[model samples]
Target: MEGRQLQQVLNPQRLKALQEWMQKSSITLTQVNGQRKYGGPPPGWQGPVPGPGCEVFISQIPRDVYEDRLIPLFQSVGIIYEFRLMMNFSGQNRGFAYAKYGDPVTASTAVMTLHHYRLPDGGCLTVRKSTEKRQLRLGDLPTNINQVKLLTLLRMVSDGVEDVMLKMAGPKGREVVALVNYSSHYAASMAKKVLMQAFKKHCGISITVKWTSFSKSKHVSETEQEDGTSTPPGLNPFPKPSISPPHLHPQPFLHNVPAHPPLQSSFSAVGGPAGPPRDEMKPQGPVNCDTVSLLQWMCEVHRLGTPQYEIRYHHASSDGFLCFSYEVLIPCFLIPLYGVIQILPGPSAQATKEEVYRAVAELVIQTICKVSSLRPF
Candidate 1:
């Protein structure tokens, strides 16, 4: 079947599979006169032809200039397909504009020569390929899309992905840029349609997918690099929260508990007890249970240093003379301790290890007095 006939017969699934190999590529047909005597206005040196009917973006124009200014400047050389001054939400000119010339010859000449010219109001004009290639193409896609990924997605949407390329700006890792390339205009149009409705969230930033004509130098191949490296952690989505040393019962063990009770995962389960053996000090029962292992895993995944943790048990009947000591509490117990300390009285929270310990001990001592023998652990 020819292109259009094949398109009709294939079901969506079959159409999807063929799309990869049959990716979109722009076909530039140079219009000709039948008798061969057709000529060129070919006066000065104009660069490569943009291939008939391509569009170019013209920007940095004086807002006051209207259609009267645009028609003549562009029509003087080649056919003026259309001209538009990009506007803002209020319909005011954005200072930049876009224009489509009839064919490659006109578009290229405008980009190379007219680019540096000054508009009537002395505004410098720069002509580039527009991001709105969707006007002349196909596919549905979001605007803030990752260029490389967009091509891959376009293949899934339609058989029109013309080409895929990434552009990098700035220095190496800090480069700020967007990916761009072409697709059969149809493919480009479809991508724009799909992405606007469905693309994954990236750092809470929305995806944007559009058309581009940057098939040259600024165009990047996957292998090319201007010094790229891994992005630093924490700045990205869902970084593991770091449980700093301040959160832990600094001294994992004290006179309160005898054994550090190696939890079996973290090597930081260092320095045994301060007093006597765990059993001798307090009629020790099973110090660790199956749950400790699970807790250890959570700590590792959450980056909570388990071995440096503690759990302190105290005598319930100490009156106001209650004294408590650091006994290396696991992150499970310590995290809540942080909350408890939040509403704690003033002078007690001195931001020092001694102050925190003192405050926690004081709160526990007072809160526990109201409790009976079965103290809430």
Candidate 2:
């Protein structure tokens, strides 16, 4: 039976017809920040927001498949609260998506019923409970980093930092460890991906980052309270730094702009007379290859003035991923480049803006490298 379904999906003519049918159907699909959402809190939904364990992570979908087929199949188990399929720029599915139900029991039913369910493209879906872990443990931090300062730094470099607690680690308490809480699991996951690199690049610090189990984190908090080492209620931990880093200064040019406007409708800036000598722009020593730094270096080497950016926050998903649309005006380019990025919710608008800036910078650099005949680097 599954083989027959696979045959039907693989038939070019039938697949085309199926796609055409879906296009004409009333199902509303919207693309936002790299994900194709069928229904965010599906239409007519009146239930309370889903809690932990209410979502199932699904994988092994065929790239050609879309929500048209997947949604109805999953609906057999329970009412879907939301469905998001990660999409590629090339108009293909990323072979994985998320299906959220209204309650944990329904979510579990999805896993039990859908796990290893065969798809029409000869793929067996891998369905499981979403971990939804929302805390991270950062180790080997500078011993001098107090909770307040560390919290500030984390907010600057990453999004969705909710709280920070510091503790001594290593022999003789020579090292500091921070247990950071993010507003959502997605935020904690994003921070885990970039915290080490961000710390090294921006703060010149090498630290360890790892996901902490809730039980482990709870134990640590309890221990701190018992030892009377926790920060007192209503008291600030550590004094604010006297001087802020130059690079950490907020970019004044960034502001909310209309999203998805035509290229000609967006702001554009032409390159001014070359600012600095070419050699000064290109680092004499080993270059920092991180996206933002690398793009800045490239702009300098090519004599383009500093890049200008505009970022706008869109709606966040029920799962806690904040979506943003961004545009970067490279002085050398004829038009600004724009795209979407999703990150965990940030503590402030500025933190979210910084994440979008890095994302758009990387996109611009890639575009330049792809189109330039001569190697710019």
Candidate 3:
């Protein structure tokens, strides 16, 4: 059983026949070679100790709505043993989480009756039976966000974030790029949910949202695929959110923040060639010596004019992170680092820096989207 190949292991069979045979036959069917047993321990044998309770998962709820708004809604369906909103690595909501009831019957009742119940905000809530653990993101933040901002914001959300990185990128003068990394992928997903709600506080700037990890690589939509990292986010493996008891804590206010890097980088080079200088870089989770660094093969950025800049993240390293980038050459342009977006008035007239920036920010915001807020999706 340990080293046997598929050809030598359990014989592939019609699932229906196997199910019928298993139910009728007192003799257990080990496999192609009959080396294992597929039955309970013994007649009067008791099962091993039970661990955590099964989870009842819920997803797609908008974050601005709070725990108070939710508890009663669920209670209307069944007596919940416990309830909680899961936080992510960046302190955002993962748009999904879990709940638990005192018994399986109660959990089942909720699944059947309240799985798709409507929220006060008028969004469909998706619920399901689950057994996995729910990772917490900690708290909330503004929705007009990027990865870096989320990581920073979530440290305030909970105590578990050991490390995280959020990045944002896109063409200069266009929407700049941003993504947030969490010490745990679970934490990152939760942060995204909470951040979208909290960040939407600004007048008309709702941060665009998407997810990438070792698993599903594509953004939540075609729009979020600006910096495509293939079909998967690298190596993410997903375990759905499960049910559990709830835990609450008084959240913090926005006014308080750690001494931040005066994020003065200009809008012209948003999510540009070189990511923020590797200041206090946090190494990813521990790996064996064989685990290599996922750094760039080659990269360089060249500004041609106001509408364009050349960038290259060549996947030069044969077996390394297949990194690559593109160059912009539209109204040729060059934007200085740490400045506002400067849409040069003409081909090469010294851009009235302030005026140019204001114009560009307005245009990019308009083109990408006019989203004032984001509810759960």
Candidate 4:
């Protein structure tokens, strides 16, 4: 009967409902005086109590595992108050879960019995009493997102974003998602709105979000008679009439980029410096390995790293480094037959006009002349 009651609480529909409620209500994992205005701890709960055996954190949940596997494993020793596996926006496990027992003694017993127990998937569990219960995972972000860009977007939503994680995702295991941990639940709740706006503005797509926090115990007096089946105590398991933040509209991120207009060539169209038409140009000339050798020598002399040279019927491109001592990056493009190579300065590079443009036309022309004389077939 005890095991049967535990299974009822772990039902998929019930868990889904709890997750939805938690997301809609902006439930959090931390205990704070300011959270009362948002919503107090979940239904049938007293408040935060700091002591041993109240709760245990399981840090290594295998991917194949679920509530069914977890509920029975923990309930073997004692009656549990609540159990929750932290989930991301995509409804995938975030590699951790939490369980609180009816009493501190039961919690300790479970910890001792199952701390290092290995799961079927070969993952050993890390269960121990939780002390610092303040963590939340942000999910449903676009794939291949730049971290710096994501951070800038998050800051637009809240000033309390303390950490960020980009983890693997997708059915094919090829996509990436973002996870943000805020200093407080309030900041995290507010983050949801701003992140949504940021996603739409930057990615041009709507995103889903889910909130996951550690479970806490309901007040002992409020849950004395029942079999142990109840919604796990989270930030607020039961919704209450609470004041909402008046404004959740997110402002633009600090590094937000404005739309760019179509690119126009600096060289004009008719009779421009872009040179002769493709049909009018001479046939493919003899290949110039000397120029390639010279380019390689130049790269080596300056310790600019290895350079790649490409040659095609129409033109060629080669990549070469400018500096080797530090991390300064300058992009230098070589245009075939055009005689000039354009070197663009990096963002933080303090290069002067002279440093940006170096005359290598003479060498290029010489190499082309020497190579062109060899053949034209």
Model 4 root-mean-square deviation? 25.5
For model 4, what is the error of residue 304's alpha carbon versus the real structure, in angstroms, after optimal superposition?
Answer: 63
Q: What tens-digit string does per-residue lDDT give for candidate 3 at 149-186?
A: 55565577533354332222233222343323344223
lDDT of 1 by residue, 214-239 (tens): 12234432311111111111112211
Locate the minimum summed-lDDT window of 10 residues in model 2.
Answer: 264-273
Q: Which ten-residue region of model 3 has the weakest summed lDDT?
A: 290-299
TM-score of each: 0.28, 0.46, 0.24, 0.26
Clashes of each: 40, 2, 60, 1
- For candidate 1, the lDDT comes to 0.35
lDDT values for all models: 0.35, 0.58, 0.34, 0.42
Across 127-186, the per-residue lDDT of candidate 4 in tens digits comes to 755432222345566666788887777776566776565655456555565556565334
Candidate 4 residue-wise lDDT at 318: 55
- Residue 96 error, candidate 2, Å: 3.0
As for lDDT, the candidate ahead, 2 or 3, is 2
Higher-TM-score candidate among 2 and 3?
Answer: 2
Tell how far residue 95 is off in model 1, in angstroms. Answer: 2.2
Considering TM-score, which of the candidate structures 1 and 3 is the better prediction for this target? 1
The number of the candidate with the highest lDDT is 2
